[model samples]
Target: MKKPLKFPDFKDEDKAADWLDKTDFSDHLEPSDLKKINLPNLKSTKRLISLRVEESLVEKAKQKAVKLHIPYQTLMRQVLHRGLEAI
Candidate 1:
């Protein structure tokens, strides 16, 4: 039987990447160590764009966002989503 491999300590990200690139951990890892991940659909992801709105409106949204414990941008998205649903 092949001996189980031990993970090496790296000083920084570049070393870690170098080690990862060269080493195969399949022999050392158990089935339980693997996890299934679902990546988001790139087509449906949000795109950043420039939108101009009144400063007072942004301040109101910021105040509301603080009260709801969420980022103002998130609050804006929620509001926009609701408005779109109403249309």
Candidate 2:
């Protein structure tokens, strides 16, 4: 019988990262180590369209997005959606 795989505890994030970088985890993993997980499908219907806007507006959006910790494109989508709803 094969020995069960074990993971060593690391003192810090850097140590963990170093261990992961040097180790091939697949070599130690067994079928029993796997777990079944059911995650909701995140498929969305979004079309890619090219549109031109002022460079200043895009820069403003990017700055605001950084403050809000979201992507500029997502901020633009939310702004457009809100505008459409208001109309």
Model 2: lDDT to the true structure: 0.75
Model 2: per-residue Cα lDDT over 1-87, one tens digit each = 245556676655445555667887666667667766432332344679999999999999999999999999989987996699799
True-vs-predicted CA distance for residue 77, candidate 2, Å: 0.3
lDDT of each: 0.75, 0.75
lDDT of 1 by residue, 1-87 (tens): 345666566555445555778887777667667656443322334679899999999999999999999999989987996699799
Model 2, runs deviating above 4 Å = 1-42
Best by TM-score: 2
**Model 1 TM-score relative to the real fold:** 0.51
**lDDT for residue 37 in candidate 1, whole number 0-100:** 45
| Candidate 2 weakest lDDT stretch, 10 residues | 37-46
Model 1 alpha-carbon drift over 4 Å, by segment: 1-44
Tell me how far the alpha carbon of residue 44 in candidate 1 is from the true structure, in angstroms, after superposition: 6.3
